[model samples]
Target: MNTDFLKVLFEISEALVTEELAALKFLSLDHVPRRKLEAIQEPKAFFEVLQEKDLIGVGNLFFLKELLYRICRIDLLTSLGSSREQMERELRILGRALVSAYRQLLYRIAEDLTPEDVANVKFLLQKLLPKNKLQEDASMLQIFLEMEIKEIIKEDNLEFLKDLFQRVRPDIKKKIEAYEGKRKENYSREEVRYPVSVQPEEKGAEGGAAKEHGKIYKMKNNPHGYCLILNNYIFKNPSYNREGTLQDGEAVKQVFTWLQFETVEYMDLERKDICDTVKEYSRKDHRNMDCFVCFIFSHGEKGKIKGVDDECVNIEDLVSCFTGTNCPSLAGKPKVFIIQACQGSEPHPSVKVEPDCSGHLEVDASPLTSIPDKADILIGLATVEDCVCFRSHETGSVYIQSLCEKMRLLCPLGVDLTSILTEVNNEVAGKELEGYKQMPKITSTLLKRLVFKVPQ
Candidate 1:
């Protein structure tokens, strides 16, 4: 090893805490064996093991950067002369991210839980884990490592963890479901892209040959799925009428129809009607369909959207209608919900300078965390939590219109739904909307890349 590389490693090792070292070791389990990692206590010895395994070296530092990034030690990344953006860009290429997304998911769940939640989890797992492993000070990461050693929760097997969480933390259980959905989606994609040669006729072909295509959601049905639009244009209160919402509805309809979805729009629905409509779709036989999508253009308050009758419906309740238990046919499939409503009453402050067409803008009220904690569900909000999203009196809202335009331009090129939404986010965020700004938010538990196939 180069002296310079050794110096860099020394600096990085000094910065990592005990918990972070444990985390780095856990993340490296796929590369290095568990027994080898168990013998390594300090960061220096761990680095030496990684070097011996040929996982990291002076010239090859990608794995080193990944380990630091995985532990969220971005500050320590400068020692490697790397930035977060650089790591993200490199990782976007398929297979560059050596760490499995499944492993990352578990690590994230560990990070999200509080100390009390961790303790609760340990208490609940008393029967499964040994007494020493379930000690008072054992971190969630350590507990998870123990679980893996006992084959309780592996990348493919999360049911055991899911069942345990249901008894302790139901919310975390939903996260596991989301992870499982994504894993299945990825597995299917791999199977499709790289099929195993079981036939005798294919025995002459080269071994390990695989397609270079990325994983995409299967969209093969005639009418791919329902694209329901609940457009609230005229409220019972005359002053609350949404002027340009019809344009949003029309744009969504045109794009989804072009994509071959069974697009339908409902005008000025009351609160009860909105709930009923979502539930009605949830009850429909979607066995033949590939996905389900819904769009809501309405005024609202925190955690709820308003109806034409000025009554409010909880967004969470509406989203939960399509959960696996409620809508079994659509289980393991994508359920997308796009809302063109302000998450809150405050306009986002702006610093950039670019003027767009001026028009009367209105605010819808709601909080950001309205989506249900279920797998294969994605909620695209018009704005961030506690911030306002703008709608033009002339054209449609910035978010919905940009989303439609990007989908039209990118879907034909095979861009996935999340990437298209990200483009919309960039477009909308760049525009100076009436001296303010709007940053769209995407909350997704989608398992795979949802690439809509355009009809021939």
Candidate 2:
């Protein structure tokens, strides 16, 4: 996990401080002094106060941990003089606290595990435990958290769920001991590896433009594809609130043009129109192209992006339109989706850049049919899921500008797409606006490096 992502999570947890008073009462601290509780605003101070009374326990430690994460985010983690040992000590405390509290949290989540909730739990577990190590654990919790569970969970998996329940509430551990056996089918981690480089098809001295293996390869001077830009500026639906994104659209269009793509711009589309446009675009002949680029600028919520009409389209469903199975011409080509939208509505605290500064910025399975796990696709989100992304009414989004700048400079020098995106992440994360910060998330499954070589 990226530290910036952890920082965002910590920042979000700060909003749950309303649970503080209840946490205090649950810890058996009625006898503890008010002055002491008043001083327990930050993690270290709070923990010290708890140390005095030895009150941290499973009943309230989870709340304490949440508070500590917030404290670390706002102050302790960013302090200049904090030693590595001091940081490690804090982590050790958190680790110890979690061991005593995880079962309860896990148990609560298991009681109602929607795929969305499962994704959130998985994020936490991945943060606390190494993914590979978690996979090796025969514990029912591990099995449930595995990615395969997203596809199917039937009667065969019920025993594992029962095992999880038994562990969380040990009073039933003995009663459910018979259900603690291995899953009927254990998931081995998927193997993911890519070739070093794939050569472009030879076209005479002009550069061979021949299609090989049903894949359209790029050539200098002609990209053989289009850049689809969906810029929703004059949002008709008042509920969806319009954003000033024309500058972003123009900037992206200019950059993609410089990169040798023919830009296709769509302004203020309705939700159904957005889907129809993509489906219509997918029908274009892509036999001479190297890849496809789709940039969507809109408001969004968890798992879905909204068009001007406030109608939402699941990002997965939108991207699925261009999948290899649906659009055979792009079967082996890269499909890049750059979404410049808020994944959630939470705004970052404003920072004063000069002195105070301000800043900016899921999966599941189904019954009838689900999007087949697609390959050769890359989605560069402006921010993590469920977070607001910032834009400069003056300069465009922090993400789009940085991305265009980096790609413009890096692609000409032969930088691969992933490497360019890493730089974009660094550039965007380094910026602060009105006390807010943004980080771009890149999810890619390309089997070969995707470098936009400048057409010679």
Candidate 3:
């Protein structure tokens, strides 16, 4: 709506019409019928200005808007929890506008790739839909748009994007599969491909609520002793993803389901302000008081975590809430946090890292807890400051995957909680990313050693 903010984009788009010589590699790709991305290799001054504009303020907002527009436009609406028609139309208009704007900016920048700008675009796009299942939606157009962008541009802003994806990937991926399924049904002439649908073992997940509070219980109900799950998204406005809206509230559904405390799945609630759904479920279940195991995944700023309204919740909110002095249910039971986002706004001016098979190097080996405590709590982070967390175009969170892997092997072996997390940290650190590795962090305060299972 703010034309001033958008004016720069229209100006940059104009050069795309007139014949301009392509220079760099990002530009050489034939992405769309009308839109072609060429590398902008020269004009350091121009690029400097471009980068400067890309920093923060009007330009950043425009970038965010256009980026969101492109994602909504390309993901092509699908049916899951919402309507396809509505999402489709919105994507069409937005898709066209974003490409037009994107191309215009590219041309204006003389067709060279702006690393930050392009990285930002890629990051936002990753959030828009399922990056791994780009072809699932009947969105050959958006795919082309992204492909043109993806192949040419190499970026480093992916950690933020990966954190975001870890949070919303389930809903977004499910939509992509639905979109592909529908495309096959409606437009049988076209080919369709889908990603692997990795669902949790139904036994523990489908089981109902937990029954005790202070008392540590076994899987009298099912195999999963605890479920540490986190679904963090900035649900401030209607979702621009077209297919559906991501409500902070759905956390309630997950929380309630996860409340089957006897069966743990390691989902944490790092996001401070949960949706109405989450709150309502908590109230009804009230089971969290009996026996608590909750993990949060959300935006963090040092000791502070993000709430729905940009409010920050201290990291200890998760554990302290259930401390013996506070809520009686979790007086000393294990409370876990599996965070996957930034901890603060500080600029971690470290060395630019080489990409490894694991995606990044361990910036530091500092432990999550510099000191030890007696309260039973465990914490895990995706990465250190400003570093990109590796995402599987195939699996979900590397940290989580490692956690589950460790759980599967150790739980049956009666591995204690600390030992299991130790293995997680070691496995992550041992991962050879061109010899560099990601050292995961963990902090625990437990009086009783939590062995996943007892010896036969």
Candidate 4:
């Protein structure tokens, strides 16, 4: 490296430290160590202290570097007499040194990373490792690092992780179980704890080719799967009903059809009809397809969505019909549910608008049947729980319209489903009617990336 380049590196490193302190201030983290922030001015000394304190591991440092790069890149471009590519090449070289520090830190505390830290490290590894590195190596740590971030943060479930560890690293698995045995449910919220391992694949044979980086297996020629839509637009009791849902159902059908899904549209289904239809469809052979989707458009109250006859159907009961146990054909396969309905009776606070600036659960009760852990399921709600979902009678609900638009555009660009959903959420959330607002929420247990290939 040239002496001038070295000087720029040092300056940028110091600037990163300063930006970090500014970020802490903005985030209002009052207890951040002052000495630590000061030490970052001296790169070598800062890393030394980091290792001594076990503050952050290699993966985390990479993320911080990423943040630092975003913050200081424009300044670096103007100040350093180097091309953008050249600057990136040099920064990557320096990043390797940070990775080296992470490895040393990892040795000092191999199993001590928090779940969030593990997540950050996993992202770094994905960036740094050769493509197919995880696929080529199925060892315990490698597999654990490759699992989904959602799996790491799942609530009150360690069985999946334990099983995976037991299969690969029995010694560590034993220790984990022993610790778990002694633990009580009640504990201080601030205490640090070891992260649980990840669940092993339920169907190992299905994803061999998809193990490649940035690629997923998509069904060829054949329609991927069913788009089961329950459009309860015309209710027997007009007071407990919705309009514009017919249009929403048609919009969903068109989008999914373009996506190569065989759309099965239903309308005016009573509560029993909804249950019967879901069960019937779930029983069919989905082995030939890559995934499944179900969309419901109806009026609903908290925890219960209404059918055409104005009867209440518990949302959980409807969803539970397609769980891994109930829908064995779809086990280990993706099942997506997009629900467009009011989750409660209360409307969002709305104000009168000027024409110009546009904006801008279920119950089930008896018999004590156990609900299986939901895996391979992705649910996207129009509105959050206990909130009214709005519709434009002539157009469609805001969520479906935004979602279909995003799916039409992004799906062809090879964007994964979750990322597309995120964009959909942003688009809907940014929209405003008078003062009313909406933000969609996506809760997923999908293990593989789902990408639709729109034929040219």
Candidate 2, residue 67: the lDDT equals 33
What C-alpha RMSD separates each model from the true structure? 20.9, 21.1, 20.4, 20.2
lDDT of 3 by residue, 115-186 (tens): 443444445565555667343322323333454455532122233333433444444334434444644473
Worst 10 residues of 2 by lDDT: 361-370
List the candidate 3 regions with Cα displacement exceeding 4 Å: 1-228, 233-272, 275-291, 344-374, 384-388, 432-436, 454-456
Per-model TM-score versus the true fold: 0.54, 0.49, 0.38, 0.50
- Estimate, for each residue in 160-192, the C-alpha lDDT of model 4 and write its tens digit: 555644554456556555545534332232122
Query: By the TM-score metric, which is better: model 1 or model 3?
Result: 1
The candidate maximizing lDDT is: 1
User: lDDT of all the models against the reference?
Assistant: 0.81, 0.56, 0.38, 0.56
How do the residues 1-456 of candidate 2 rate in per-residue lDDT, one tens digit apiece?
Answer: 224333433554454353433343223233356456645654445544553442332112223443334233325333322333433443443112222222333333343445544454444456544576454322434444342235223323444444444544444444334332321111111011111233454433233322322223344337646899987776675544444366577667666776778889998888899889999989988887868999988776677767777777887888888888889999988888888876665655544543211222211011111234788888888876556777655345777766875664455445577877887886666656556666668887776667675654
Better of 1 and 4 by TM-score: 1
lDDT of 3 at 202: 25
lDDT of prediction 1: 0.81
List the candidate 1 regions with Cα displacement exceeding 4 Å: 1-214
Q: Report the Cα lDDT for residue 357, model 1.
A: 35
How much is the lDDT of residue 84 in candidate 2? 36
User: Residue 4 lDDT in model 4?
Assistant: 39
